[model samples]
Target: MSEEIKVQLTATPGEKPDSQKLGFGKYFTDHMFVMDYHKDKGWHDPRIVPYAPIVMDPAAMVFHYGQAVFEGMKAYLTDSGKVLLFRPDQNMQRLNCSNDRLGIPEIDGDFVIHAIKTLIEIDKSWIPTEKGTSLYIRPFIIATEPCLGVRSSYTYQLIVILSPVGAYYSGGLEPVKINVESDYTRAVRGGIGFAKAAGNYAASIKAQENAKKDGFSQVLWLDAIEKKYIEEVGSMNIFFKIGGKVITPAINGSILKGVTRSSVIALLQEWGVPVEERKLSIDEIFEASQQGLLEEVFGTGTAAVISPVGELHWKEHTMKINEGKIGELSQKLYDTITGLQSGNLPDTRNWTITF
Candidate 1:
């Protein structure tokens, strides 16, 4: 239960990758942050150690029962040579939400943020300064108790890793093609859909793989019950702009409340743009496209920040959004958010933390 974070610097640092070729989550820094939790001892021994594989028992609960949760965030090395994190506190808070759903013990979100800052300080050089590049931070918790019973593990591990990554999408802000998946459902209400649990992503890989095989960059998931209502994109929350009003699926119990999504909504509201959160249907979107009302479609997440959707293929019909080009609103949002992240724009909303 000691609050001090023990730091262990790597003796042989890994070679830095070329900034231009730094793809997302491909390269890891020299060190990582780790903490362990037990029902008796609680979370203790917070430390930063060399980046390496974690040794776990073959019968660990996370392997059999899948009691794992993770989060995605980024650290930007601004043009002013300042290290910045955009809404990291929100990510930590969501991590606890996931932990609650997965039956994992909740660590102090503030203390974890402090540990993250310390980890970043030790590996600040790993934060890329290139345009459209930043250090991607992944904080994950996994059940480590070596028991195979159908219950929550008594021991857990919380690990944070850093990777210097370029744009998540190879095309940067270029629009991407998406496939509407009706055959498979990502999650249902009263499930782990709202949490960033590992099982949710595991359940999605099949649908995403099928979409990729059909020449789509991602899959637009539908609700599990009826498979009619729009839920979200595979890795990002979705937004549709029809007749100049923005609409996104309301946060029911099944959608991941993305940090970037919230930020985008805030920005739109501050600019006096109309935004709505409600139950949206795929049929309604296709209808809007037919009527020339579906002006823009985009996805938001920590990885891409803003990804414009060019085309959506549902059943036999195809809906091309914004004429297969990034919408004005999408471009403006990308520019504004990236500007704020990189310190090019003023922090009017105080969304970023700098070191």
Candidate 2:
């Protein structure tokens, strides 16, 4: 039997309703899960505590050097009134992978799973059941040792927080407009891009903000060295369909190995939708758009199962894909993935874990 971890809960007396309606990481739940790790004691003092501010040293490694890693996932409520997690073990595994890369201490996967389950049980009421709405779970680790050095800290804190989110797109699943960043780079060879580290995101926020300023939703990042081949979109893995073939950038050292990206490839292969994983160049995609062969482009991640890319703006040149509408394959992919996640379809892979 697993050890029973204790949590001290304090409820927020009166909180207003979540009215933002926009669903990309907004309103946070009342409570959060936290655990600490030290050199001698290892991981201890695990608890599900109230969501509040945490005090940290100004010179903490995470604050200065950005030695932090995080994972994104969701808890879904099915039509049968059961709360379930979709492929949580995969997320735990990825978390460990990220920890290894970020020089953070590793926690047992089963222990982390138990902690998450406990936290969800306590905050189950916060999960939204509306369509395209669920509880977004964020698990992250931060270096907390007080020091001014650049090396990894001997102390760390792991926390999991919940947020109730609505749909990712504001206009109801409309395709997104992307800006191709030719100058800024998201990741590079031998970099921490594959890991869900904080620095990777901090480095891209400026580029993303610039894209948003130019009337685009996100930045479609490219390779760091050459800035030619496509890497990924902001916070999501990208996919493109042309000539009836689905093509996604291969998992090089620079690109994140997204769970949704892998699942999409598997499902497409099962459905016999010719799929290819290779280095997809931006120039090739532009040419394909000119020839009217680019059928669709989309991003896959935990936040948005599949966010369609309707247009790309590169170097003052605009290329519209799928005529600024969601493609058939994009719809099918979304339906299939969501069906599996929501228990509406047969989960042949046993991806769902009921609570």
TM-score of every model?
Answer: 0.98, 0.96
For residue 65, give model 1's deviation from the true position in Å: 0.8
Model 2 per-residue lDDT tens digits across residues 1-355: 1445777788563363474563567678778888888989888888888888999988788888888999998888888877788888888888898999989988787788778888888777777776788888999999999998779899999999988888676556789899999878988989898998999988999999988898999999999888899999988999999899999999998999999999999999999999999999999998999899999999999988999999988886899998899999999999998888888888898788887
Question: lDDT by residue for model 1 over 86-148, one digit each (tens)?
Answer: 988899899999999999999898898888899999999999887788999999999999987
- In model 1, the worst 10-residue window by lDDT is 166-175
lDDT of each: 0.92, 0.87
User: lDDT of model 1 at residue 151?
Assistant: 96
Q: Provide the lDDT at 126 for model 2.
A: 78
lDDT of prediction 1: 0.92
Question: What's model 2's lDDT at 206?
Answer: 94
For model 1, the superposed segments whose C-alpha errors exceed 4 Å read: none
